[model samples]
Target: MLNTQHYPQMISPSLMGEWIVIASEQEFVQRQQIKTCLDGQTLTLHRDTINGVHVYQVNFESLDMKELNLSVQAAYGFVWLCIGSEKKPLFQLQEYDVEGARRVPCGAYGVRTSPLRGIENFLDMAHFPYVHTGILGAEPETTVKPYKVEWREDVDEIWATECFFTQPLAAPSSPQPQETEYVYRVASPLNAILYKVNTAAEGIIPADVVCLFIQPLSETHIRAHLLMILDDQTSSMTDMVLFQQKIFTQDKPILENHVPLKLPLEKLEIPTKADALATAYRKWLITKNWCYGVHKNTQEEQVV
Candidate 1:
Protein backbone atom coordinates (compact mmCIF):
# COMPACT_ATOMS: atom_id res chain seq x y z
CA MET A 1 0.00 0.00 0.00
CA LEU A 2 2.93 2.30 0.69
CA ASN A 3 6.33 2.73 -0.92
CA THR A 4 8.32 2.34 2.25
CA GLN A 5 11.43 1.75 0.18
CA HIS A 6 11.36 5.35 -1.00
CA TYR A 7 12.91 6.51 2.27
CA PRO A 8 15.32 3.78 3.30
CA GLN A 9 15.76 5.15 6.83
CA MET A 10 14.27 7.68 9.19
CA ILE A 11 16.24 10.92 9.03
CA SER A 12 16.67 13.06 12.10
CA PRO A 13 14.30 16.04 12.20
CA SER A 14 17.15 18.39 13.00
CA LEU A 15 18.93 17.35 9.84
CA MET A 16 15.80 17.26 7.72
CA GLY A 17 14.77 20.78 8.70
CA GLU A 18 18.06 22.17 7.45
CA TRP A 19 18.95 23.02 3.86
CA ILE A 20 21.32 20.22 2.89
CA VAL A 21 23.51 20.31 -0.18
CA ILE A 22 22.63 17.70 -2.84
CA ALA A 23 25.22 18.56 -5.50
CA SER A 24 27.21 21.40 -6.98
CA GLU A 25 25.27 23.50 -9.47
CA GLN A 26 27.68 22.40 -12.18
CA GLU A 27 26.49 18.80 -11.83
CA PHE A 28 23.01 19.63 -13.09
CA VAL A 29 23.58 20.19 -16.80
CA GLN A 30 20.57 20.89 -19.06
CA ARG A 31 17.66 18.45 -18.68
CA GLN A 32 19.64 15.59 -17.21
CA GLN A 33 18.29 14.15 -13.97
CA ILE A 34 20.81 13.68 -11.18
CA LYS A 35 19.94 10.89 -8.79
CA THR A 36 21.31 11.13 -5.25
CA CYS A 37 20.49 10.57 -1.60
CA LEU A 38 20.42 12.63 1.58
CA ASP A 39 20.23 11.30 5.15
CA GLY A 40 19.20 7.94 3.69
CA GLN A 41 16.48 9.47 1.54
CA THR A 42 16.59 8.92 -2.22
CA LEU A 43 16.36 11.99 -4.44
CA THR A 44 16.18 12.83 -8.14
CA LEU A 45 17.11 16.24 -9.52
CA HIS A 46 15.94 17.68 -12.86
CA ARG A 47 16.66 20.95 -14.61
CA ASP A 48 14.80 22.14 -17.70
CA THR A 49 15.54 24.86 -20.21
CA ILE A 50 12.61 27.04 -19.21
CA ASN A 51 12.24 26.23 -15.52
CA GLY A 52 15.03 25.91 -12.94
CA VAL A 53 16.14 22.83 -11.03
CA HIS A 54 13.47 20.58 -9.51
CA VAL A 55 13.84 17.91 -6.86
CA TYR A 56 11.66 14.81 -6.47
CA GLN A 57 11.11 11.97 -4.02
CA VAL A 58 9.37 8.70 -4.78
CA ASN A 59 5.60 8.72 -4.52
CA PHE A 60 3.82 6.49 -2.06
CA GLU A 61 1.15 4.62 -4.06
CA SER A 62 2.66 4.78 -7.54
CA LEU A 63 6.24 4.41 -6.37
CA ASP A 64 7.41 6.83 -9.01
CA MET A 65 9.46 10.03 -8.80
CA LYS A 66 7.22 12.86 -7.61
CA GLU A 67 7.90 16.47 -6.88
CA LEU A 68 9.41 16.84 -3.42
CA ASN A 69 7.59 20.20 -3.19
CA LEU A 70 10.03 21.39 -0.55
CA SER A 71 12.35 24.33 -0.35
CA VAL A 72 14.93 24.19 -3.12
CA GLN A 73 17.41 26.93 -3.90
CA ALA A 74 20.88 27.53 -5.31
CA ALA A 75 23.67 29.55 -3.78
CA TYR A 76 27.44 29.53 -3.52
CA GLY A 77 27.69 27.15 -6.49
CA PHE A 78 25.67 24.36 -4.85
CA VAL A 79 22.07 23.13 -5.14
CA TRP A 80 20.43 22.90 -1.69
CA LEU A 81 17.29 20.98 -0.68
CA CYS A 82 15.31 21.05 2.56
CA ILE A 83 12.91 18.11 2.86
CA GLY A 84 11.26 19.19 6.08
CA SER A 85 7.82 20.75 6.03
CA GLU A 86 9.04 23.99 7.56
CA LYS A 87 12.27 25.19 6.04
CA LYS A 88 15.08 26.94 7.80
CA PRO A 89 17.14 29.64 6.13
CA LEU A 90 20.35 28.62 4.44
CA PHE A 91 23.68 29.81 5.84
CA GLN A 92 25.55 32.79 4.33
CA LEU A 93 29.07 33.52 3.08
CA GLN A 94 29.98 37.18 2.69
CA GLU A 95 33.42 36.34 1.36
CA TYR A 96 31.76 34.92 -1.76
CA ASP A 97 30.78 38.43 -2.73
CA VAL A 98 34.29 39.85 -2.86
CA GLU A 99 35.25 41.22 -6.28
CA GLY A 100 37.78 39.32 -8.40
CA ALA A 101 37.80 36.34 -6.01
CA ARG A 102 38.55 33.16 -7.88
CA ARG A 103 35.86 30.53 -7.27
CA VAL A 104 36.98 26.91 -7.30
CA PRO A 105 34.60 23.99 -6.66
CA CYS A 106 36.36 20.74 -5.82
CA GLY A 107 34.78 17.48 -4.85
CA ALA A 108 31.83 15.16 -4.68
CA TYR A 109 33.63 12.24 -3.08
CA GLY A 110 31.58 9.39 -1.59
CA VAL A 111 33.36 9.26 1.74
CA ARG A 112 32.97 6.18 3.88
CA THR A 113 32.61 8.08 7.15
CA SER A 114 30.17 10.21 9.11
CA PRO A 115 29.62 13.79 8.03
CA LEU A 116 30.31 14.84 11.61
CA ARG A 117 33.69 13.12 11.56
CA GLY A 118 34.63 14.95 8.37
CA ILE A 119 33.76 18.31 9.93
CA GLU A 120 35.73 17.51 13.07
CA ASN A 121 38.70 16.52 10.95
CA PHE A 122 38.49 19.82 9.10
CA LEU A 123 38.54 21.65 12.44
CA ASP A 124 41.58 19.82 13.77
CA MET A 125 44.95 21.61 13.72
CA ALA A 126 47.20 19.02 15.35
CA HIS A 127 46.91 16.57 12.46
CA PHE A 128 48.14 19.06 9.87
CA PRO A 129 51.78 18.19 10.38
CA TYR A 130 51.22 14.47 10.02
CA VAL A 131 48.18 14.23 7.76
CA HIS A 132 48.57 17.16 5.40
CA THR A 133 52.35 17.21 5.68
CA GLY A 134 54.46 19.63 3.57
CA ILE A 135 51.38 21.32 2.22
CA LEU A 136 49.46 22.45 5.28
CA GLY A 137 52.21 21.75 7.79
CA ALA A 138 55.37 19.82 8.52
CA GLU A 139 57.46 18.59 11.46
CA PRO A 140 59.24 21.05 13.82
CA GLU A 141 56.25 23.37 13.36
CA THR A 142 53.66 21.04 14.82
CA THR A 143 52.48 23.29 17.59
CA VAL A 144 48.81 24.43 17.63
CA LYS A 145 49.10 27.69 19.46
CA PRO A 146 46.41 28.85 21.89
CA TYR A 147 43.11 29.70 20.19
CA LYS A 148 39.69 30.91 21.31
CA VAL A 149 36.43 29.20 20.46
CA GLU A 150 33.00 30.68 21.01
CA TRP A 151 29.41 29.52 20.61
CA ARG A 152 27.57 32.40 19.03
CA GLU A 153 24.02 32.05 20.36
CA ASP A 154 22.55 34.57 17.97
CA VAL A 155 23.88 32.89 14.84
CA ASP A 156 23.54 29.33 16.17
CA GLU A 157 27.08 28.69 14.97
CA ILE A 158 30.56 28.11 16.38
CA TRP A 159 33.59 30.29 15.72
CA ALA A 160 37.23 29.57 16.49
CA THR A 161 39.69 32.45 16.29
CA GLU A 162 43.26 33.40 17.15
CA CYS A 163 44.49 30.06 15.83
CA PHE A 164 48.03 29.91 14.47
CA PHE A 165 50.08 27.23 12.77
CA THR A 166 53.40 26.96 10.96
CA GLN A 167 53.14 25.60 7.44
CA PRO A 168 55.44 24.52 4.66
CA LEU A 169 52.90 25.91 2.20
CA ALA A 170 49.90 27.76 3.56
CA ALA A 171 48.22 28.72 0.31
CA PRO A 172 48.76 28.45 -3.44
CA SER A 173 50.26 31.95 -3.38
CA SER A 174 52.63 31.20 -0.50
CA PRO A 175 56.21 32.03 -1.49
CA GLN A 176 57.60 29.50 0.94
CA PRO A 177 57.11 27.88 4.33
CA GLN A 178 55.57 30.44 6.63
CA GLU A 179 53.33 30.95 9.62
CA THR A 180 49.59 31.06 8.99
CA GLU A 181 46.61 32.38 10.93
CA TYR A 182 43.26 30.63 10.74
CA VAL A 183 39.67 31.36 11.66
CA TYR A 184 37.18 28.49 11.47
CA ARG A 185 33.43 28.88 11.34
CA VAL A 186 30.88 26.10 11.75
CA ALA A 187 28.09 27.53 9.64
CA SER A 188 25.72 24.65 10.18
CA PRO A 189 25.62 21.02 11.23
CA LEU A 190 26.70 20.10 7.71
CA ASN A 191 28.71 23.11 6.51
CA ALA A 192 31.84 24.95 7.64
CA ILE A 193 34.19 27.67 6.45
CA LEU A 194 37.94 28.16 6.83
CA TYR A 195 39.43 31.65 6.67
CA LYS A 196 43.16 31.91 6.14
CA VAL A 197 44.80 35.34 6.41
CA ASN A 198 45.98 36.57 3.00
CA THR A 199 49.69 36.39 3.69
CA ALA A 200 50.42 37.67 0.19
CA ALA A 201 49.01 41.03 1.19
CA GLU A 202 47.71 40.86 4.75
CA GLY A 203 45.79 44.04 5.51
CA ILE A 204 45.18 45.00 1.92
CA ILE A 205 43.77 41.72 0.63
CA PRO A 206 40.87 39.73 2.04
CA ALA A 207 41.37 36.31 3.58
CA ASP A 208 40.82 33.37 1.26
CA VAL A 209 37.84 31.20 2.23
CA VAL A 210 37.47 27.45 1.85
CA CYS A 211 34.06 25.92 2.52
CA LEU A 212 33.07 22.32 3.26
CA PHE A 213 29.50 21.18 2.64
CA ILE A 214 28.46 17.63 3.45
CA GLN A 215 25.55 15.58 2.13
CA PRO A 216 24.73 12.75 4.51
CA LEU A 217 23.86 9.78 2.36
CA SER A 218 23.55 7.71 5.53
CA GLU A 219 24.66 7.77 9.12
CA THR A 220 28.08 6.38 8.17
CA HIS A 221 28.33 7.66 4.61
CA ILE A 222 28.55 11.14 3.14
CA ARG A 223 29.46 13.21 0.08
CA ALA A 224 31.70 16.21 0.66
CA HIS A 225 31.71 19.31 -1.59
CA LEU A 226 34.26 22.09 -1.47
CA LEU A 227 34.17 25.68 -2.74
CA MET A 228 36.94 28.21 -2.50
CA ILE A 229 36.71 32.02 -2.72
CA LEU A 230 40.25 33.14 -3.17
CA ASP A 231 42.12 36.38 -3.87
CA ASP A 232 45.34 34.82 -5.16
CA GLN A 233 46.40 36.77 -8.21
CA THR A 234 49.27 34.50 -9.14
CA SER A 235 48.12 30.87 -8.95
CA SER A 236 46.02 29.54 -11.83
CA MET A 237 42.58 28.06 -11.11
CA THR A 238 43.74 24.60 -12.13
CA ASP A 239 46.66 24.81 -9.70
CA MET A 240 44.36 25.82 -6.82
CA VAL A 241 41.89 23.04 -7.51
CA LEU A 242 44.67 20.46 -7.81
CA PHE A 243 46.23 21.68 -4.57
CA GLN A 244 42.95 21.24 -2.72
CA GLN A 245 42.32 17.85 -4.33
CA LYS A 246 45.70 16.66 -3.08
CA ILE A 247 44.85 17.72 0.48
CA PHE A 248 41.51 15.94 0.25
CA THR A 249 43.05 12.74 -1.07
CA GLN A 250 45.39 12.80 1.93
CA ASP A 251 42.45 13.23 4.32
CA LYS A 252 40.05 10.72 2.70
CA PRO A 253 41.80 7.54 3.83
CA ILE A 254 42.31 8.89 7.33
CA LEU A 255 38.66 9.82 7.65
CA GLU A 256 37.40 6.49 6.28
CA ASN A 257 39.47 4.50 8.78
CA HIS A 258 37.87 6.10 11.83
CA VAL A 259 36.65 3.30 14.10
CA PRO A 260 32.87 2.93 14.62
CA LEU A 261 32.29 5.04 11.48
CA LYS A 262 30.03 7.53 13.21
CA LEU A 263 31.43 9.89 15.84
CA PRO A 264 30.86 8.59 19.37
CA LEU A 265 29.79 11.71 21.15
CA GLU A 266 28.83 10.17 24.49
CA LYS A 267 31.89 7.96 24.97
CA LEU A 268 34.43 10.24 23.39
CA GLU A 269 38.03 9.71 24.45
CA ILE A 270 39.81 12.45 26.37
CA PRO A 271 40.76 15.21 23.98
CA THR A 272 44.04 17.09 23.90
CA LYS A 273 44.30 20.89 24.18
CA ALA A 274 44.68 21.14 20.43
CA ASP A 275 41.15 19.78 20.03
CA ALA A 276 39.37 22.82 21.40
CA LEU A 277 37.42 23.50 18.22
CA ALA A 278 36.63 19.83 17.76
CA THR A 279 35.38 19.46 21.32
CA ALA A 280 33.30 22.57 20.97
CA TYR A 281 31.73 21.20 17.81
CA ARG A 282 30.60 18.06 19.63
CA LYS A 283 29.22 20.10 22.51
CA TRP A 284 27.34 22.30 20.09
CA LEU A 285 25.81 19.28 18.41
CA ILE A 286 24.83 17.87 21.77
CA THR A 287 23.19 21.17 22.67
CA LYS A 288 21.13 20.99 19.49
CA ASN A 289 20.25 17.33 20.26
CA TRP A 290 21.68 16.25 16.94
CA CYS A 291 21.37 12.51 16.31
CA TYR A 292 22.25 12.04 12.68
CA GLY A 293 25.58 10.43 11.82
CA VAL A 294 26.55 10.15 15.48
CA HIS A 295 26.96 7.35 17.98
CA LYS A 296 25.77 7.58 21.59
CA ASN A 297 27.81 4.71 23.09
CA THR A 298 24.86 2.38 23.34
CA GLN A 299 25.25 -1.41 23.54
CA GLU A 300 23.16 -2.04 20.43
CA GLU A 301 25.34 0.28 18.35
CA GLN A 302 26.38 -1.23 15.00
CA VAL A 303 30.10 -0.84 14.31
CA VAL A 304 29.82 -1.23 10.55
Candidate 2:
Protein backbone atom coordinates (compact mmCIF):
# COMPACT_ATOMS: atom_id res chain seq x y z
CA MET A 1 0.00 0.00 0.00
CA LEU A 2 1.23 3.52 -0.74
CA ASN A 3 2.05 5.34 2.50
CA THR A 4 0.13 8.59 2.51
CA GLN A 5 1.38 9.29 6.03
CA HIS A 6 4.65 10.84 4.77
CA TYR A 7 2.93 14.10 3.82
CA PRO A 8 3.02 17.14 6.11
CA GLN A 9 0.35 19.71 7.02
CA MET A 10 2.12 23.08 7.36
CA ILE A 11 4.72 24.75 5.13
CA SER A 12 7.70 25.00 7.44
CA PRO A 13 10.82 22.78 7.44
CA SER A 14 9.73 19.16 7.59
CA LEU A 15 7.01 18.65 5.00
CA MET A 16 6.51 19.02 1.25
CA GLY A 17 3.79 19.53 -1.39
CA GLU A 18 0.96 21.94 -0.45
CA TRP A 19 -1.58 24.49 -1.67
CA ILE A 20 -1.64 28.18 -0.60
CA VAL A 21 -4.78 30.18 -1.39
CA ILE A 22 -5.35 33.91 -0.84
CA ALA A 23 -8.30 36.12 -1.71
CA SER A 24 -9.97 39.50 -1.08
CA GLU A 25 -13.62 40.54 -1.41
CA GLN A 26 -13.35 44.28 -2.02
CA GLU A 27 -10.73 46.83 -3.02
CA PHE A 28 -11.55 48.90 0.12
CA VAL A 29 -10.04 46.17 2.33
CA GLN A 30 -6.83 46.48 0.36
CA ARG A 31 -6.52 50.26 0.96
CA GLN A 32 -7.41 50.06 4.67
CA GLN A 33 -4.66 47.57 5.54
CA ILE A 34 -1.60 48.03 3.37
CA LYS A 35 0.76 46.34 5.83
CA THR A 36 -0.19 42.74 4.96
CA CYS A 37 0.03 42.82 1.16
CA LEU A 38 2.91 40.53 0.18
CA ASP A 39 4.07 39.99 -3.39
CA GLY A 40 1.17 42.36 -4.15
CA GLN A 41 -1.75 40.78 -6.00
CA THR A 42 0.63 38.46 -7.81
CA LEU A 43 -0.71 36.06 -5.18
CA THR A 44 -4.43 35.35 -5.75
CA LEU A 45 -5.68 37.04 -2.56
CA HIS A 46 -9.13 38.37 -1.71
CA ARG A 47 -11.09 39.61 1.28
CA ASP A 48 -13.58 37.67 3.43
CA THR A 49 -15.57 38.02 6.69
CA ILE A 50 -13.59 37.40 9.83
CA ASN A 51 -15.27 38.34 13.14
CA GLY A 52 -17.49 40.68 11.13
CA VAL A 53 -14.55 42.36 9.38
CA HIS A 54 -13.72 41.81 5.73
CA VAL A 55 -10.18 40.65 6.36
CA TYR A 56 -7.69 39.15 3.95
CA GLN A 57 -7.47 35.37 3.83
CA VAL A 58 -4.63 32.95 2.95
CA ASN A 59 -5.04 29.17 3.05
CA PHE A 60 -1.98 26.92 2.85
CA GLU A 61 -1.90 23.12 2.71
CA SER A 62 1.67 21.96 3.24
CA LEU A 63 3.91 19.74 5.39
CA ASP A 64 5.75 22.62 7.13
CA MET A 65 3.00 23.74 9.50
CA LYS A 66 3.87 20.71 11.63
CA GLU A 67 6.59 22.61 13.50
CA LEU A 68 4.67 25.89 13.76
CA ASN A 69 2.14 25.20 16.50
CA LEU A 70 2.01 28.75 17.77
CA SER A 71 -0.90 30.46 19.51
CA VAL A 72 -3.32 32.43 17.31
CA GLN A 73 -2.12 35.57 19.06
CA ALA A 74 1.36 35.27 17.49
CA ALA A 75 0.46 36.69 14.08
CA TYR A 76 3.85 37.67 12.74
CA GLY A 77 5.30 34.62 11.01
CA PHE A 78 4.51 34.17 7.28
CA VAL A 79 0.81 33.37 7.38
CA TRP A 80 -1.22 31.07 5.12
CA LEU A 81 -4.84 31.96 4.31
CA CYS A 82 -7.12 29.22 3.09
CA ILE A 83 -9.72 30.15 0.42
CA GLY A 84 -12.79 27.97 0.08
CA SER A 85 -14.28 26.91 -3.25
CA GLU A 86 -16.27 30.14 -3.47
CA LYS A 87 -12.97 31.98 -4.06
CA LYS A 88 -13.27 33.34 -0.53
CA PRO A 89 -10.71 32.92 2.23
CA LEU A 90 -11.85 31.25 5.44
CA PHE A 91 -9.18 32.65 7.83
CA GLN A 92 -5.86 34.46 8.13
CA LEU A 93 -2.70 32.97 9.65
CA GLN A 94 0.53 34.99 10.06
CA GLU A 95 4.33 34.55 10.05
CA TYR A 96 7.18 37.01 10.47
CA ASP A 97 8.80 37.48 7.05
CA VAL A 98 11.95 39.24 8.17
CA GLU A 99 14.19 38.25 11.04
CA GLY A 100 17.52 39.95 11.92
CA ALA A 101 17.24 42.12 8.81
CA ARG A 102 17.73 39.17 6.45
CA ARG A 103 15.16 37.85 4.00
CA VAL A 104 13.65 34.73 5.57
CA PRO A 105 13.42 31.47 3.61
CA CYS A 106 10.96 32.28 0.82
CA GLY A 107 11.70 28.85 -1.43
CA ALA A 108 13.90 26.59 -3.86
CA TYR A 109 17.65 26.31 -3.75
CA GLY A 110 18.31 25.77 -7.47
CA VAL A 111 21.96 25.54 -8.52
CA ARG A 112 23.73 25.36 -11.86
CA THR A 113 25.92 22.52 -13.09
CA SER A 114 28.36 24.59 -15.17
CA PRO A 115 29.30 28.20 -15.99
CA LEU A 116 28.10 27.78 -19.55
CA ARG A 117 24.82 28.43 -17.67
CA GLY A 118 23.23 25.68 -19.72
CA ILE A 119 22.33 22.52 -17.77
CA GLU A 120 20.40 23.26 -14.56
CA ASN A 121 19.01 20.92 -11.93
CA PHE A 122 17.32 21.11 -8.56
CA LEU A 123 19.59 19.79 -5.81
CA ASP A 124 18.30 16.39 -4.74
CA MET A 125 19.30 13.78 -2.15
CA ALA A 126 22.02 12.44 -4.43
CA HIS A 127 23.98 15.70 -4.42
CA PHE A 128 23.89 16.32 -0.68
CA PRO A 129 27.33 14.87 -0.02
CA TYR A 130 28.83 16.24 -3.22
CA VAL A 131 27.62 19.86 -3.33
CA HIS A 132 27.57 20.46 0.42
CA THR A 133 30.94 18.83 0.75
CA GLY A 134 32.09 20.21 4.10
CA ILE A 135 28.98 19.41 6.10
CA LEU A 136 27.37 16.59 4.13
CA GLY A 137 30.16 15.12 2.01
CA ALA A 138 29.41 12.40 -0.57
CA GLU A 139 29.15 9.11 1.27
CA PRO A 140 27.54 6.48 -0.92
CA GLU A 141 28.40 3.87 1.69
CA THR A 142 26.94 5.74 4.66
CA THR A 143 23.79 7.01 2.97
CA VAL A 144 20.67 6.64 5.06
CA LYS A 145 18.16 4.31 3.49
CA PRO A 146 14.45 4.55 4.20
CA TYR A 147 12.95 1.59 6.01
CA LYS A 148 9.65 2.21 7.84
CA VAL A 149 7.98 5.28 6.33
CA GLU A 150 4.45 6.70 6.54
CA TRP A 151 1.99 8.98 4.71
CA ARG A 152 -1.30 10.64 5.64
CA GLU A 153 -4.08 13.04 4.50
CA ASP A 154 -5.73 15.03 7.23
CA VAL A 155 -6.12 18.63 8.44
CA ASP A 156 -2.33 18.39 8.96
CA GLU A 157 -1.17 15.86 6.38
CA ILE A 158 2.40 14.49 6.19
CA TRP A 159 4.76 12.46 3.95
CA ALA A 160 7.70 11.43 6.09
CA THR A 161 10.82 9.49 5.04
CA GLU A 162 12.33 8.04 8.18
CA CYS A 163 15.64 6.20 8.13
CA PHE A 164 18.79 5.73 10.17
CA PHE A 165 22.42 6.43 9.29
CA THR A 166 25.20 3.93 9.81
CA GLN A 167 28.37 5.85 10.74
CA PRO A 168 31.71 4.11 11.03
CA LEU A 169 33.51 5.73 13.95
CA ALA A 170 31.19 5.50 16.97
CA ALA A 171 28.47 2.92 16.37
CA PRO A 172 27.54 -0.48 15.08
CA SER A 173 26.51 -1.11 11.45
CA SER A 174 23.33 -3.18 11.83
CA PRO A 175 20.02 -1.76 13.08
CA GLN A 176 21.71 1.68 12.60
CA PRO A 177 22.71 3.72 15.59
CA GLN A 178 21.01 7.11 15.50
CA GLU A 179 23.73 9.76 15.40
CA THR A 180 22.95 13.06 13.73
CA GLU A 181 19.38 13.62 12.60
CA TYR A 182 18.17 15.49 9.53
CA VAL A 183 14.64 16.18 8.37
CA TYR A 184 13.35 18.28 5.43
CA ARG A 185 9.84 19.47 6.19
CA VAL A 186 7.59 21.56 3.93
CA ALA A 187 4.44 23.24 5.21
CA SER A 188 2.77 24.74 2.08
CA PRO A 189 2.29 27.59 -0.48
CA LEU A 190 5.97 28.59 -0.45
CA ASN A 191 8.53 26.38 -2.20
CA ALA A 192 10.94 26.19 0.75
CA ILE A 193 11.81 23.70 3.46
CA LEU A 194 12.68 23.70 7.14
CA TYR A 195 16.04 21.95 7.56
CA LYS A 196 16.89 20.43 10.93
CA VAL A 197 20.14 18.59 11.53
CA ASN A 198 20.78 17.74 15.15
CA THR A 199 23.32 15.76 17.16
CA ALA A 200 23.02 15.46 20.91
CA ALA A 201 24.29 13.17 23.65
CA GLU A 202 24.36 13.01 27.45
CA GLY A 203 24.88 16.73 28.13
CA ILE A 204 26.40 17.88 24.86
CA ILE A 205 23.95 19.09 22.26
CA PRO A 206 24.24 20.56 18.77
CA ALA A 207 21.55 21.72 16.37
CA ASP A 208 21.54 23.52 13.04
CA VAL A 209 18.18 24.83 11.91
CA VAL A 210 17.03 27.08 9.10
CA CYS A 211 13.79 28.35 7.60
CA LEU A 212 15.06 28.61 4.00
CA PHE A 213 12.69 30.72 1.95
CA ILE A 214 13.03 31.35 -1.78
CA GLN A 215 10.99 34.01 -3.58
CA PRO A 216 10.78 34.62 -7.29
CA LEU A 217 11.63 38.32 -7.39
CA SER A 218 10.66 38.45 -11.03
CA GLU A 219 10.64 36.15 -14.08
CA THR A 220 14.46 36.13 -14.10
CA HIS A 221 15.56 37.11 -10.56
CA ILE A 222 15.06 35.38 -7.18
CA ARG A 223 15.87 35.85 -3.50
CA ALA A 224 16.86 33.62 -0.60
CA HIS A 225 15.70 34.31 2.95
CA LEU A 226 18.03 32.60 5.37
CA LEU A 227 16.75 32.36 8.97
CA MET A 228 19.36 30.20 10.54
CA ILE A 229 19.58 28.88 14.11
CA LEU A 230 22.94 27.24 13.87
CA ASP A 231 24.82 25.60 16.76
CA ASP A 232 22.05 26.46 19.18
CA GLN A 233 24.00 24.84 21.95
CA THR A 234 27.12 26.99 21.52
CA SER A 235 26.84 29.97 19.18
CA SER A 236 25.25 33.35 19.90
CA MET A 237 23.36 35.64 17.52
CA THR A 238 26.51 37.68 16.85
CA ASP A 239 28.51 34.65 15.83
CA MET A 240 25.74 33.07 13.78
CA VAL A 241 24.71 36.15 11.81
CA LEU A 242 28.12 36.94 10.39
CA PHE A 243 28.73 33.29 9.62
CA GLN A 244 25.48 32.99 7.68
CA GLN A 245 26.09 36.23 5.83
CA LYS A 246 29.43 34.89 4.67
CA ILE A 247 27.82 31.72 3.41
CA PHE A 248 25.10 33.64 1.61
CA THR A 249 27.67 36.00 0.12
CA GLN A 250 29.65 33.06 -1.18
CA ASP A 251 26.54 31.71 -2.90
CA LYS A 252 25.10 35.10 -3.92
CA PRO A 253 27.16 35.66 -7.08
CA ILE A 254 26.42 32.17 -8.34
CA LEU A 255 22.84 31.83 -7.07
CA GLU A 256 21.84 35.22 -8.46
CA ASN A 257 23.13 34.37 -11.92
CA HIS A 258 21.41 30.99 -11.92
CA VAL A 259 18.79 30.65 -14.67
CA PRO A 260 15.16 29.89 -14.01
CA LEU A 261 12.71 27.68 -15.91
CA LYS A 262 10.91 30.75 -17.25
CA LEU A 263 11.61 30.23 -20.93
CA PRO A 264 9.12 28.37 -23.09
CA LEU A 265 9.08 24.61 -22.41
CA GLU A 266 10.88 23.79 -25.63
CA LYS A 267 13.71 26.21 -24.78
CA LEU A 268 14.87 24.22 -21.75
CA GLU A 269 14.12 20.52 -21.64
CA ILE A 270 16.74 18.32 -20.01
CA PRO A 271 15.73 15.46 -17.74
CA THR A 272 17.48 12.63 -15.89
CA LYS A 273 17.18 10.33 -12.88
CA ALA A 274 18.40 13.23 -10.66
CA ASP A 275 15.11 15.01 -11.39
CA ALA A 276 13.03 12.45 -9.47
CA LEU A 277 12.01 14.83 -6.66
CA ALA A 278 11.23 17.62 -9.10
CA THR A 279 9.18 15.17 -11.12
CA ALA A 280 7.24 14.21 -8.01
CA TYR A 281 6.73 17.90 -7.32
CA ARG A 282 5.46 18.47 -10.84
CA LYS A 283 3.08 15.52 -10.55
CA TRP A 284 1.76 16.79 -7.23
CA LEU A 285 1.38 20.23 -8.79
CA ILE A 286 -0.69 18.75 -11.61
CA THR A 287 -2.92 17.14 -8.96
CA LYS A 288 -3.49 20.64 -7.56
CA ASN A 289 -4.61 21.59 -11.06
CA TRP A 290 -2.30 24.54 -11.25
CA CYS A 291 -2.40 26.52 -14.49
CA TYR A 292 0.64 25.19 -16.28
CA GLY A 293 2.31 27.54 -18.85
CA VAL A 294 -0.67 29.86 -18.56
CA HIS A 295 -2.90 31.75 -16.16
CA LYS A 296 -6.23 30.60 -14.72
CA ASN A 297 -8.25 31.06 -11.54
CA THR A 298 -6.74 28.78 -8.87
CA GLN A 299 -10.02 28.38 -6.96
CA GLU A 300 -11.41 26.80 -10.12
CA GLU A 301 -8.52 24.37 -10.02
CA GLN A 302 -8.73 22.87 -6.50
CA VAL A 303 -10.07 19.30 -6.44
CA VAL A 304 -12.62 19.97 -3.75
User: Judged by TM-score, which candidate is best?
Assistant: 1
lDDT by residue for model 1 (84-134), tens: 453347888876766677788986888999889989998999999999989
TM-score of each: 0.89, 0.45
- What lDDT does model 2 reach? 0.33
On a 0 to 1 TM-score scale, where does candidate 2 land against the true structure?
A: 0.45
Give lDDT: candidate 2, residue 285.
38
Displacement of residue 304 (Cα, Å) in model 1 is: 6.9
Off by over 4 Å in 1: 1-10, 49-69, 85-87, 201-205, 300-304
RMSD of 2: 13.0
Overall lDDT per candidate, in order of appearance: 0.80, 0.33
Q: In candidate 2, how many Å is residue 294 off?
A: 8.9
